[model samples]
Target: MLKRQEVKIVGMGGQGIMVIGQLLAHAALIEGANVVWFPCYGPETRGGLAECTVIISSDEIGSPVTSTPDTLIAMTQPLLDKFAPTVKPGGVIFVNTSLAQPPKYRDDCKIVEIPANDIATELSNPKTANMVMLGGYVELMKPVKLESLKASLKEVLPEHNHRFIPINNTALDKGAEVTSR
Candidate 1:
């Protein structure tokens, strides 16, 4: 059986870190997995630093906060410096290459650098980096099915933005394809 996975996504303000947590939680819920979503509320909610954690488990979750994580997705430079040390050994680290560069340290964990923001910009939506990363995570982690993710997106995204779903789905597929390599 696949073990439950804990993921921590850290980024500066306006990076959609919290949305990533929510999306993961929703996807996990659809998968019939126990889910916990936690976000770090700060004065910089607008221009300050922000972070969110999403814990997906096969069993009941204990707490929403996580001091350690099975996976770390650092979307900014500060986030990379702050939470990179907390990632567990053999865990996966998905770094946003657009804002945050790769870390210098050599850890035992697997690290993948993705230009999610660039891809999102090319897709004509700068805010779609989170979705791009989500797609990449699905491919890299394989924690949940892509079909499940698409269904959740359809349910969660507003109806007026329905036209953008296919574009976002393509972004996800692109991200996943690159990460799968």
Candidate 2:
């Protein structure tokens, strides 16, 4: 079991940042870890900045907010610039190379770059980029079981949108595959 883990996901407001965070939190819950998810966004709902912080641990959480994250998932260049320095040493950063430029090389932490938008477009949706990034993170860190994350999708997604579950699953799997290679 992980003693503690903190993840920060940042991107444009409509990039499904919150959904990824919620999915991770729910998956951690399914794994019986204490978890907290806090989301923040700018005024505009579409292009404005948005972010979510998720903390999962085996013990009680002292706080919900995290200043330094163990992992950072950035879907935009600006977001990456703003949060890259806040990652703890030996942490990991996942970048959406389709939209954001890669961060400067840092030996302290690992950087996993994925062309999320391009991958999603290949899947014909272009919106599951967040899921792709999330999948890569899951596969790289193994914070929670892949089965648990897949199962949590039904709960995180609304009933009416269940039709897209299969596609989202594919995106996640593709993400894992990309990172594994």
Candidate 3:
């Protein structure tokens, strides 16, 4: 697996889209990689678009953005539709099939579809769908250690929110289970 990664994560507001970006950033930092987390949000606070780009590299990074990412984590159908073509050839795309229909046209890249929302619901925390997607990506590509991401939850989440760590960890583990060979 490559240590250098450029990832784009997308979902609606309040879906922990930015949280997973931060988790990746922190996980990269923990692994001693240069990293950047760039977030973009739509006008509406909770229902509109929420997305971010995460760059992780062992070498010094020149930018936090990428037009062609190594991976795409699409938490919604609209985002999957819009960004699937932006992934580079042989790259990976993780789609939340609970909401987004599978892409029918592209065959250049590997597509891993996980019903993240359904998985999260099974875990009793719908908010961790983003983490589910992240977990699967981490399991498949190993951009960072799974333990690093587990350790990063505290840093990415607020102190008052710490109580949810166990569930989040479980969600991540469940996600990994789905993709583990």
Candidate 4:
């Protein structure tokens, strides 16, 4: 069994961090990989700090908590500070540069600051920052194909909101392209 890639996504309430975790897990599933997704759901309904841990592996998972994640996506400043130090050596941090500032820690981990909110706003959907950041994270990780992720999104997103799918997909692609450069 191949080792799984662990990702910890952190954000405040209403950031759709849980959905982002789900999308990543589904993308892994589409690629025939094993995935375990667990979200800290309690007391998260009133603008509280929330996070979700996703493990994507070619083998079965061991635990839900990732002490040292291979990658971290922070959508808020506090989250960035709280989780930045926990990333494993040689790990990556996908930062929502629009919300979180650059961290003081500058060694071991690779940090990529992306203007997720700005890009989403430009795309006419401010709430799509999650998808935008997902794109950037995927580019940084390159664990799966971009097309596979998009296909998973199309399947997972609500049916009535299908019109926004193409826009979100483009946002994901834009983020991927920018980060991969």
Candidate 1, residues 1-181, lDDT tens digits: the string is: 4578999988877877776677778888898888888888678538677888888888888998878898998888887888898988888889889988777683678889999999999888888888788889989897788777777777777789788788878777878877988
RMSD in angstroms, all models?
1.6, 1.0, 1.2, 1.6
Compute the lDDT for candidate 2.
Answer: 0.92
Winner by lDDT between candidate 4 and candidate 2: 2
Whole-model lDDT values for every prediction: 0.83, 0.92, 0.90, 0.86
Candidate 3 lDDT by residue in tens digits, 91-160: 8889999999878777988889899999999888888888888899999988899999999999989999
Off by over 4 Å in 4: 1-3
Model 3 local distance difference test score: 0.90
The total of clashing pairs for model 3 equals: 0
Alpha-carbon deviation at 34 in model 1, angstroms: 0.8
Q: For model 3, name the residue pairs that clash.
A: none
Across 81-153, the per-residue lDDT of candidate 2 in tens digits comes to: 9999999999999999998877776579999999999999999999999999999999988889878888999
Give me candidate 2's TM-score against the actual structure.
0.96
Q: Can you give the TM-score per candidate against the true fold?
A: 0.92, 0.96, 0.96, 0.93
- Candidate 3 least-lDDT 10 residues: 1-10
Q: Record all residue pairs in model 4 with backbone atoms less than 3 Å apart, i.e. clashing.
A: none
